[model samples]
Target: MARELEEVKWEKFKLGDLFRIKSNLQLNKNSFVFSENGEYPYFTRTVFNNGILGNVHYLDEEHKLKGNCLAVGMIAMRFFYMDKDFYAGQFTKRAIPIGFSLNSRLANYFITVLNKKSKIFQSSLVRNFEKVFKNEEVKLPVKNDGSIDFEFMTSFISELEARQISELEAYLVTTGLSDYVLTSEEEKFLEIFRENEVKWKKFKIGDLFEVNSYKKRFDANKVNILEEGHPYVVRTALNNGIRGYLKEDEEFLNEGNTISFGQDTATMFYQEKSYFTGDKIKIIKSKYKEFNKLNSHFFVSAMSKSFSTFAWGSSSFSISIIENQEIYLPIKNNEINFEFMETLISAIQKEIIKDVVLYTDKKIKATKKVVSNK
Candidate 1:
């Protein structure tokens, strides 16, 4: 049996008319704070990861006295989204519904729709807040009885979420094993080959590769669906650290190139495909034959972890340090067979692709169920 798409009536509403955008109150560094095991969770802008927080900052009695703080089910919109409530911080624009109970699930759905519609909120920086606010409008669907189907909507989303989490877990396990296999073999070979016939030579990264940065910028409107052979890399893709070419604006980067994050506080995993984005990302072309032997995952793991240490503790350190950093390599004419290593890596990559496809299929099936119910 099929549930027919019902003709649902929707009311047009300006978000500003029904919601009050609250200004964030800053907490002083000197304020009293509680330990991790505190009485209440301190809410902040970062708490808006899909409208839930696993861990929260804490505030003491005095800090809590400062009024205008939100309670747990309050609808928040950090930025312009359809109706999804997001936790607001000093940086994000917060919204409070005027006369309705905060329906967190409904709000999340609206935000998801808005995100699908535009990419304005993808970046933390607000470039055109005024324009975005003025142009945005939300449509509230009404049931036959003129009331929201809160339970049905929530259940619909919950099913999808549960399915996604399961698929993600499976994907993680398969990829982790694949990575282990690739890294373990690469390490074993390097140790054996390096010791036998070659004297290790140290060289700076800049001496072996041509580092380039793309200067052209594209707006959200200019981006297209990620397809093969298109240039795309952004902060979020780097954050995903998946191996595959991303679909993005054709004008963003030079065709057929590899990129790595250079500036993020968190280490990004390397993927086989290019389509990554981040401010501190490095784009490189290897000038040496050994450069092809440089496994993307191994290199990114080393750089991200090392660079993050420097960024957190030292102000003078920059990714430019890579240009001067020493790397130990085997002598050119030695019996080190890089081609054999590449073949092993390629096999590992194929296994990863198989896992990704399996996970993707599960996700698609789950998505279909949710969409059908809707």
Candidate 2:
């Protein structure tokens, strides 16, 4: 933030002017379509778990319960971002963005800002939300031209995420933490990217990987009966979908060094250890060769860009669909440039590790000084 938040210009905008209020699906936990292995999120007024009650499948094809909207809980005054198609329970409503797309980052920022206005709400549930929100004004940053500064909102959120890893300038070498800084190789890579001169080639996922599906899903609720052993992966989009560590079943334990993808939930994580899953987890293995952890990071980025569109409708992101999906990767001499990915990720990790090393060193020094005083 170059300027302080308080220093930024703010403008008030009515909610009705920004979004159209739509009724929720009006489904409950016991709806006939609800399933533990369902495709879309079922939102409710609960103040926990992002207001999601559960997931459901086999929804009405003609129903207009779409994602990319803000789902609001009137009674609980809860707000949640629906990035993918979801079903809304009773007493909830959707805030469909009128003119622009609400990317996840922007939506999250809005949620935080919107919750600040919770004090104005009354005891009555906002059943007539359209009329209520029509007069509701939310303050937002505005440009000199009086337009909402969407770019600032996105970049601020992005910078916050990057700040978690710290600023970069050094690289840790063997034996000790050495400040290598930016090497010529990295400078070249960065320059090419800055100039938009990097070439890319499209590769079909099925051509590069073998997609295996584990159908026999162990229930997370019932897993307590088995002796505790391995990780129990599930379909949630959070925490890499690892519900908990459960006892491994030889028949269900998937091998390590594989990409575990939630068949319907669209959650993905590289399984560094052999783990069991709850159900419908698609295990992806590279057909050419095993991708290392660094390379898997590149793959995950590519997969997200290509597969995010799969959730725009009622289509299931099944194994077959994943197989046929094509992702773009950096190209060198018309071939997939694995070296570039490896080098880029390696450089980034070294920089991050340097920050950790410096932080730990400072902490150790402070502790030593305290001990000496004692």
Candidate 3:
């Protein structure tokens, strides 16, 4: 009741024989800017994930008119034969296939097969590739009808795409539900909002915290994360609004007693945590009696929302910018308890973490079912 695995004869061929391989046009020192009304889509290493496109960057007319490039559905294999050549920085390799003459549907299927088989080839010339591409051999299956079964291959790929879309929709729905839950809790807490404006006083964050100005040391060969070393933070991570404890066992700074924030993308993402391996993070340590309650995780999350305004308020990176950034704090005798709010937030975080684990399991099961059927 299931289709048997076809035992078609396979032919081996060189990659250079099938298509022309070339590096993308270097954009010099100019930064890429995305335009909504731009003429053409810009492709990059980030475009490919599990053999699919993510986001397309748009370029103005000048760049678009230079050369006609491959469109969606073509395979792009990163070139490794030359010593001076390097794949796109974001993702090292890609495979772009010829689209017109070849069956696009079968070509898609063939690309998937190539990806699976790429791990088997090896070369001494290349340093990073698990399988060497230049001297490697691949097998091509020919159908009995002479022409490849483009229709069947297309149907299979279409089915895969449909299933993937369904899974993505489900994931979105789950994310929405989690957001709703957190928002509802925040709303409930806000309901008890007391004006008690007299009890609230403004103070500079730097006045309450000790700032440590230090740089990270880097080593190219050392990649392992240190267990009890300083954590490195960067601006890019701050812009993305990601917050968490670092797991890497490497230290760039000698001391391990502060939290870092990104200053450049502060306006876009306020107090987001950024990752760094070297001298990019600004560490701040709390110096008050409430240090236990106002730890790095709690303080970082609070700042992630307004990092831009804080960064702009300062002129130099050396001085403790926290002193200039104002925040409202509850008085010791205030009727509304600050400890209660912290406890509620902690409980909500626990629930969200649990939900994430459950959702991940469901997605894994759904993917396994689809792959098994295929």
Number of backbone collisions per candidate, in order? 14, 1, 24
Model 1: CA > 4 A from native: 1-7, 13-29, 44-104, 110-137, 166-170, 173-201, 204-226, 230-294, 300-326, 329-374
The best candidate by lDDT is 2
RMSD of each: 10.7, 18.1, 12.1
Candidate 1 per-residue lDDT, tens place, 1-374, comes to: 12122654666656556556554454433454445554333345442543223222543343332222222212233333223222222343445556664444555655565445344434323545434544567676656686655554565456657667666667666655424344565555545555674454656767765666644544435444344553345445343543234455445654233544433443334334445343555555666455443355444544454454454523323447656665554444554344544544555565556676666668667666765676
C-alpha RMSD between model 1 and the true structure: 10.7
Q: Rank the candidates by lDDT, best first.
A: 2, 1, 3
List TM-scores for all candidates, in order.
Answer: 0.43, 0.50, 0.40
lDDT of 3 by residue, 1-374 (tens): 12223654445655544444433443321465445553433444332443222222543333331222222112333221111112122223333444424343455565665555433532232243323544456555445755444445555665665577567657656754334244554545444443333344556777766655545534324544444333333444542323222445334333433455434443212222224433334556566544443233445555654354444535445445545676655444643345545544554554566676566558657656655665
Better model by TM-score: candidate 1 vs candidate 2: 2
Candidate lDDT (C-alpha), each: 0.48, 0.75, 0.44
Question: Which pairs of residues clash in candidate 2, taking residues 3 or more apart in a chain or in different chains?
Answer: 229-247
Shift in Å, residue 174, candidate 2 = 12
